[model samples]
Target: MMLWITIKVALRSLWANRMRSILAMLGIIIGVGAVIFVLSLVAAAKADMMGRITAMGTNLLVVSPGQRGTGGVMSGTQQNLTADDAEALLAKIPQIRDLAPVVRGNVQAKRLAKNSRTSLMGTTVTYFPIRSFEVEKGRLFNDADCDAMSRVAVIGATTATNLFGTEEPCNQVIKLNSINFRVIGVLKSKGDQGWFNPDDQVLVPYTVAMKQIVGVDHLNEIDIRANNEADLDTIMDRATKLLRKRHHLQEDQDNDFSIRNQAEMLKTADSMNQVLALLAGGIASISLLVGGIGIMNIMLVTVTERTREIGVRKAIGAKNGDILRQFLIEAVVMSGSGGAIGVLSGFVLAAILSRVTSLQASVSLFSVALGLGFSMGVGVFFGFYPASRAARLDPIEALRYE
Candidate 1:
């Protein structure tokens, strides 16, 4: 009953100075809202990134011909990997489920008046299943196509749009670097994947791309899939040993090839995403501190203005602890109210941003809880000194004050 009376008193005092209370809350409102807005967008971006990484395959290991070397001087990848190396690895290692020898270059693809510049990827049929690509129209090329060095291609969704517009791309012949290639399939849209876009390219048999187009005799990379995800590490080790022996490297020679696992990509993405979220949250938290200081200053002024009231209550048998409790409760009420309002505003602002921009933003229960808890914490920390000072005042001196 006494606690309820104290709460009622706090509310009445706040209502009496409504304008001052709102001004005091402005800083906290901005702080909490910013925390919500920035964190939600960060969360969304992280989800999108993880999805892209997963799409590349968590069971994958890519073998490349170069490792950037001492000073990272790379005119291009070393011309070390070849189709024979890929074939030897596949035959020797039963752990290998699928493999594709890949080479890539940029080319201008033209059809009539429409011209689109895109990266051209050259690999076997296994590249589709390994990379989780689906054929939306027509079919992916087969072993015969690679053997015959067929000038057949698969186009990504973005590339499909660029070259064919609304018309179907299947069975259409487009010119790549002035060389005619038939588009046998159009891949389902995978959207943009930031650093590497799967939906902005053309794919043809490595044989065709090497013999006639880019005129390269060596493989740029080999994308390998293990028979089981558990076999990834073992297969990587075995493949390394086999490649070293094939190239006749002695014990002193460094590896001319490098292997990359999907797990490393996932770990890197997670750490970078965490760092970004923390940075954004730290910047927004500054406003909460500023608002806390504002609350402390205003509470100090309130204690001074209510000096006579404190003296009257003390004279009427109020204890020092009682006096402290009343002032503290009043400050908490103000902050807690502001916190609730701020959370609502954050939701509204986040929704607006999601609608108006390409940014994907989402609000989570954790962010709301964090903001509210932080605001209440600010109230208690800053409201303490003023409440203690008011409690310590001598009743007689407070009563005599004009």
Candidate 2:
């Protein structure tokens, strides 16, 4: 049909000025590439963080020590959580599947002149299931150890390597805070999580940790797992009220503890990631506007250069729509090709960034679709004015211009 002929003519015109066409598309290329790269990196990071947070536990709620008021004056954080509070919550709240009272501190670990200052996690056996911890070597300490205040410890992979080197860590005695403790197990590696490395800590009974290691009777925090995801909010509310009543806090006074849930953490993470993507993607998309302008400028010059051709075709009965469609197709072809090349470049750049840098990057299908859609839209939007101008030109005036 005539439309196919017009497309061929547009292609021929672009090919005749290949260098100019490429230059016109360069802006689109960079703009789309930048958008893909930034958004992909953001997606990867959000996924990584959410994975780590979930790794800590699912349907989880953590109660940490919070501020309290003394003599009608606000005071700093107090040790307001205890094993009794944990027990009471489990007994009273039917939605609570399991709970772990945790106490942690920094301790110097030693084994035959090898020493490292690492974090200490003191909790009961339930802590493992609640926090998704699995033992790699030997066995986890049981309720008997906690009841007996046994000095058995579960060392993380990093701690094992640092303390005992290639020698077996399980059954080996290591000194923690100058006290001998037998290593009962070694935990599987959880990697360095940026904020804190879970693979670099020692685990022992909360009873022993309180009486001997940390020397504090109050728990540092209590972790609770709900019966299911649906019960998260209900459990959080009920636990908060129960704790307040247990502590005998008046309406005017603040409770001496704070509770947080995985759902809230997820929501906050999503919001933060959205803001990050918006800011970064917004900055990169500006180049697309610049590219559209370039395409419009080139199309305008093209209209002028082909004025006589346009007049000749018009005299031969080529319609105004034909001229407009031809020019518009030319701009679209240019921008569309640029978009394809840009997507490839963005994927390559994202892969490179993920490898050579600390940032995790992954090109999602959504990003590809978005980049392509935006590029093609630029083509139609910016190509319209010049196409319209070419269509409206008088055949006589165009013929006289040459």
Candidate 3:
């Protein structure tokens, strides 16, 4: 019966001051809505990033010449990773399944009068299998192609479209660096991964790229596929030991060659994603705290305006608990109602964001519940002092107030 009465009083008071009640809830609504929208978008984007990385294969490892940080910063000076390192690693590390030395350059491609710039990659025949890429049309290079340093090329799907239109690219000659190379194959699309689009590239045998095109014997990076993911640690250990021996480095010396496994990439990405989520959540929580302060302010004003009411109720057999309960209930109703409204609004905003922005959004039920629970807790926490103040007012003083 007391609960029912308290609820009735809360509803009656809010209905009487509809505008002020709405104003009080406005902060909570915005805060919760922002929490939901931002978190969903970030979660979705992280999941998408992980998915693309996983598709590149789990047992894969990237061996780069210098250390790369999270923000595209390089830790060490660029060391020359050469084809000899690839050959040595393949021969020396029995646990290693396959390897490809990747040499990259930007070149202008011309087919007839049309011209478009594309990223050119020099890689060996083993690169396709190691990277899990399949040829959509024609075939990959054979040993002869690599041995003879043939002027043959394999273009990615997007590169093919830009340089050849809808026409078949197989056996067609395209000019790169003033040399005509026959397109022997076209790679199936891999879309975009991180900073680069795999589909926006043209590939050729590493030897051809080194001798005929780029004229550099050094490699940019090396792609390695371990025999299995379980053997990755052993493989990394052996590879590191071999490279250090080859480069003649001491044990404590910083490595000239850096190895990154697929798992590390995913873990790094996940850590960054988690940090971003926390930052976003922290920023959004500030708005809720501000809204809680607003609730406290409004409740104090309410206590002042309703001084006579408090006195009358106290005189009419209402206990101090009753007065406190009424005000607390009112604050909770304001925040709870606002939280509900915010959740609905957030869903709409998240949907719109997914359609309009590149950020992928996946809404978690945990986040929604957490937002509402947080709002309710904030209401109680901020409302307590004001409710207690109203309850402790002297009946005589309250009743005599002008």
Candidate 4:
């Protein structure tokens, strides 16, 4: 019953100066809102990135040429990966289910009157299976096409839309670098993958790409599908050793290539997202700290304004603990209200972001809980000193004040 009375008094005090209370809560409101908004956006972006990376394939490994060092100074990537290297790895490593040596270039693709600049990849038929890509229309080019150096092309969904619009792109001839190639397939949309948009590229046979388009004898990269994830490390080690032997590199020499697996890439991506989220959250949290200080400052002023009221209460047999509880409850009420408002505002902001942008902002319960808890904690931490000061006031002195 005494606690209830103290709460009632706190509410009354806060209600008496509604504007001041609101002003005191403004910092917390903005702080909590900013934290939620930043976290939600970051979570959404991370999910989107992970989803895109996962879509690339399971149990997959990518091999790319490593940077070469010239006189102890690292230079640009070495063009060391070749179709022969890919073949050697496949022949030597039983863990590899499928592999494709790739060469790519950015070129203007023209089909009749329509044209679009897009990445053109030259890979084998196994590229489709290795990357888990499905052909939406017609068919993917086969190994026979790669071996025969056929001028056949497979367009991605975005590429199809950009060049052909509503018209069907399959069977149409698209010219890449002034060389005509018949479109045999259209790939299903895989959406954006952050740095790369798989849907915006075209695929052709590696032989044709090497000889006619990119004009490079060396491969840019190799996409390999491991039979199982458990065998990935063994496969990588074996492939690395085989490649080293094929390149005639000594045991002490560094590898001229790099091997990256899907799991490692996903882990790295997750770590990066976590760091970004923490950085954003840390920056936003400064407002919360400022808000806490504001609460402390306001509570101090409130104590001064109500000095005689405190005296009157103490003179009427109210204990120091009761006075402390009253002021503390007042601070908590103010901050709690601000936290509720901030949460609503954060949700609205998240919804607006989702609607206005491509990002799919997601609000987790953890974030909501964290915001509310932090706000209440701030109230308690900052409210304590002022409440204690009010409780410790000399009743006679306070009552004698003019």
Best by lDDT: 2
Least accurate stretch of 10 residues (summed lDDT) in model 3? 68-77
Residue-level error in angstroms, candidate 1, position 248: 4.5
Off by over 4 Å in 4: 1-4, 11-20, 44-52, 70-73, 111-115, 318-325, 348-362, 388-397, 400-402
Candidate 1 lDDT by residue in tens digits, 323-353: 8988888778777767777888888877997
C-alpha lDDT values of all predictions: 0.88, 0.89, 0.86, 0.88
Off by over 4 Å in 2: 1-3, 12-20, 34-59, 66-79, 91-97, 104-120, 143-152, 158-167, 171-182, 191-197, 207-220, 226-238, 252-256, 297-325, 344-366, 384-402
- Residue 279's lDDT within candidate 1 is 85
- Model 4 over residues 176-295: C-alpha lDDT tens digits? 989999999999888777778999998999999999998899999999998888988999899888888888899788888989998788898889889988886786578888888889
Distance from true location, Cα of 308 in model 1, Å:
4.5
Measured on C-alpha atoms, candidate 1 has an lDDT of 0.88
lDDT of model 2, residue 247: 93
How far does residue 397 in candidate 2 sit from its true spot (Å)? 7.4
Candidate 2 steric clashes: 0
lDDT (tens digit, per residue) of candidate 3 on 326-368 = 8888888778777887888888888898888666776789879
Instruction: Check candidate 3 and list the clashing pairs.
Output: none
